[model samples]
Target: MFAVWGLIVLAGIFVVIRFTGLIDHMLPAGDPPNFTFAPETPVPQARNFFIACPPGRSPRTDRAMPSPSFDATAATLADVMIETAPAHGMQLMSGVPGGKPGRLYFLARTPVFHFPDWVEVEFILPEQGGDITFCLFAQSVYGLDDIQQNEKRTRAWLADIVGRMGPSG
Candidate 1:
């Protein structure tokens, strides 16, 4: 069973590399402000992504409420996301233009393998003083399937963010 032993060794090596954070260097974080969130044509066909936009902002009309409406301002929501990211194993990525409101990029790694995933969030502030809405797009960097990890992580992060925002939010 040399092949079995060899496989075990390889798996161990990968685990080591992942825990050391060495795999992060090889992953692409993607260009910010370039990713399309929702209501955009030709979304990626990969199954390893999750997109959450407000009710009217997405093409999927079956979803009663795809994303939560925030009572806070975009700036406040951004602040909440920034504060909550690290706790969810995410780090903010650079390259967003300053003075441009409502766009944020983040890099997240899987808990075990450290596979990189890019997350983009766009806050939508209505002109008529309505609740703030947002779109979140999270995609894996090197996989055709992620077993719904992206959706789970996005939902958990959103819940934590809303919890932090309190009753009014």
Candidate 2:
């Protein structure tokens, strides 16, 4: 039937797009700093994103540790993120404010469909000199529902980071 043939052609086109990396061009890599990580409403209502805020701020507590300075903590975070991302099918796209000690953005692709997702992480250092904290926001670029994929990926990354960072405060 014509409908079946059309479907086959469309599927082939999608496969080509995925293989050729054209999907990256089609999906927008949103502004990292613009992502909201507020405690009251960390994630959007669409169930396509997950946000982990600092302790005492959100329902999910982020990993934190005592550090002598922000630079040291940022370096540690960057190393851990770089090591862990590839394991989860992610690659660092860019960083806000030039580089770390600020926000980092990553592009992740789903295993099956190769759907694109953007993850933004911001390192925070309290003025009072307490523990260093970071907030992470991950969202799908082309879906209204990700079936909790963002949450699972966020949790897995956090666990890996925590393991690499050793005991947290």
Candidate 3:
């Protein structure tokens, strides 16, 4: 029993080292993520990063700075809508189907430095595609006291979005 417990502890340590990117240099190029959820959504194929759940607890918004400014600088309008936003962590990047001409709004929580926490994204795409609106509302927190809460929040938020979208490319 003592030997088994020792082995378990060692295995746990190994897993942590692997997770923190320490063992990456020794591994070969990994196969792309075989996503069970969104088989059609195109994931970046050439990266060697592991998938990690977002930290659930809220960020330290009380000390966080304000949102940053985002600009749409693509030649084509569609390019402006989809491609450009996520590059800047614009959560909901999509085209509008009806109503409204063409409008884009970028939003984020305090401390634009730590983006992806909160955002308000929108754009119009004529009469075919529906308007896209991504509104992320999160806070940044630090220390061990809030870790569990933060992680829970992140997972919940991600699950909600994925649940609604079904899957993506």
Best by TM-score: 1
Q: What lDDT tens digits, residue by residue, belong to model 2 across residues 37-155?
A: 55565445566877776555443333221222233366777778888999988898774444454777888889866778888777776566555677777888877888888788887
lDDT of each: 0.75, 0.70, 0.32
Candidate RMSDs in order: 3.2, 4.9, 16.2
Write down the TM-score of every candidate: 0.81, 0.72, 0.21
- Reference-based TM-score, model 3: 0.21
By summed lDDT, the worst window of 10 consecutive residues in model 2 runs over 61-70
Give the residue spans of candidate 1 off by over 4 A: 1-12, 38-40, 61-65, 96-101, 167-169
Better of 1 and 2 by lDDT: 1
Q: What TM-score would candidate 2 get against the native?
A: 0.72
Candidate 3 lDDT by residue in tens digits, 1-169 = 9999999999988787666655444432222122221223333232211122112221322312221112222124334334444443444422323212243323222221232222222232224443232212322222223333323443444454444343332
| Candidate 1, 59-165: lDDT as tens digits | 44222237787788888888999999998889987455542355788888888767888888888887787888788878788889888888888989989987888
lDDT of 1 at 74: 82
Candidate 3 minimal-lDDT segment of 10 residues: 48-57
Worst 10 residues of 1 by lDDT: 56-65
Q: Which structure among the candidates has the greatest lDDT?
A: 1
Tell me the lDDT of model 3 at 157.
41
Q: What value of lDDT does candidate 3 attain over all alpha carbons?
A: 0.32
**lDDT comparing candidate 1 with the true structure:** 0.75
**By how many angstroms RMSD does model 3 differ from the true structure?**
16.2
Task: Determine the backbone clash count of candidate 3.
Answer: 21
